[model samples]
Target: MTDPLALRHEHAFDIRINFDKRWSTGPVYGGASIGYTSIGEGSTVEGPMLTGTLVDYSGADWPVVRADGVVELNAHYMIRAEDGALIYIRNLGYVHRPLRTKGQGPDEEPDVPAYFRCTPYFKAPEDGPHAWLNRTVIVGVGQRQPKVTAEDPPDHSLFRYYAIR
Candidate 1:
């Protein structure tokens, strides 16, 4: 069996942020190629974002920081071949949680919800120009730690971001 966390190169779409909803979606043009290594099935990656920082670059600044606000992410990807093609492909297979900047990780493990229609973006094929294809979103958390030994640790914070398909 293949390791779920194995690294692979793939094409991804541009990422767009939905300011009002505080969510991001893939681009509509063509997919952007990206290099990713699997972190493992059902594993959480945590990080921190500057308090009250805006996530979207193009939109007005909206504060994401709060006494409670922390970025949390959980998702899984799938590898498959496009129809009638021999090449193996990996896409965001499921979105388990909303993107938010918060203080800590979720208390329980997340579950993969239903699949949604991903935005189609153009991606340059290996041998030709870019073409449109629906891209998936990958979600993971970020973590911050204090400089301390394993026995005595400081605070831990979690952040989240989505990679384009």
Candidate 2:
């Protein structure tokens, strides 16, 4: 018997992103994000890893800061490939989770549930060494950590992504 679950274990690389405080007048969760992305997957044969910037926005049902459920996010990226090549990525996905607490001891409140999952499509220059990424499909799993506070709404959010091949 073939184990379908085992077949899905195609491991790729992981990504860690940091945002520079989101600004929006529309609403709390209604805004765009422009930040830096680092290659958390470590080094390969290449001299050094590439870094890039990201532009992302929330969908209609955004600002779900207080809501406990799934929220949608759309993003566009321009990244430098490992070989100093350029690659663009488009993402369509959602984060399903709840708010969090700094800590949860035996007597403390329960921890908030948070998880990020998305599908990213890559586009590479036809003549670049990373052109192969143009045809590869990638799925990402991440964790969301929204700032915890009393007066401050969810302003800062961080995510860590793991690629699935």
Candidate 3:
């Protein structure tokens, strides 16, 4: 007999959303508000089978921190494929994680309840090479780090996606 709980995933892509600055609207109903957007050489995407860069002047992410500590982020961006086909992706995720302590590794993930997870929806040309993106069920894991100044690497939110089969 096969185990029904067993699941599989295929590597899709990864990205680093470079942070430039941040501004927040103080506590309001349900939670606080955050608005994020970037332009000009936005970011890059690379992986086993995907290659693209976010379109210059077309990216935004709004992440809100609730009074209870969970963060809700909605990111919208356009990617220019190596073949020049344009793809739009909206990735929404949530987290209730604590900031990294003194010696945690950059790529480590906390236990459940502090987990950062996301679901990505894509819009690609129906007849294009990336049309697979449109129908596949993709899930992603995300992590946000801290950094400041142009000299230091900008703070970035990292994400990797996989298609469930």
Please list the Cα RMSD from the true structure of every candidate, rounded to 1 decimal place. Answer: 16.8, 8.7, 5.5
For residues 1-165, what per-residue lDDT tens digits would candidate 2 score against the true structure?
Answer: 866665343445544443333433333453433223232222122111224433232111112322334456666555555556656667667776554465556575557656677786777788756665566656667655444687653333343333333
lDDT for each residue of candidate 1 in 99-153, tens digit (9 for 90 to 100):
3334535763433332222221122234422122224333433333433786843
Candidate 1 TM-score, true structure as reference: 0.18
TM-score of model 3 (CA atoms): 0.81
Best by lDDT: 3
lDDT score for residue 23 of model 1 = 38
- Which stretch of 10 consecutive residues in model 3 shows the poorest summed lDDT? 33-42
**In terms of lDDT, which candidate is stronger, 1 or 3?**
3
Ordering by lDDT: 3, 2, 1
| lDDT scores of the candidates, listed in order | 0.28, 0.48, 0.79
Backbone clashes, each candidate: 27, 0, 0
TM-score winner among the candidates? 3
Candidate 1 runs further than 4 Å off = 4-58, 68-133, 138-165
Worst 10 residues of 1 by lDDT: 49-58
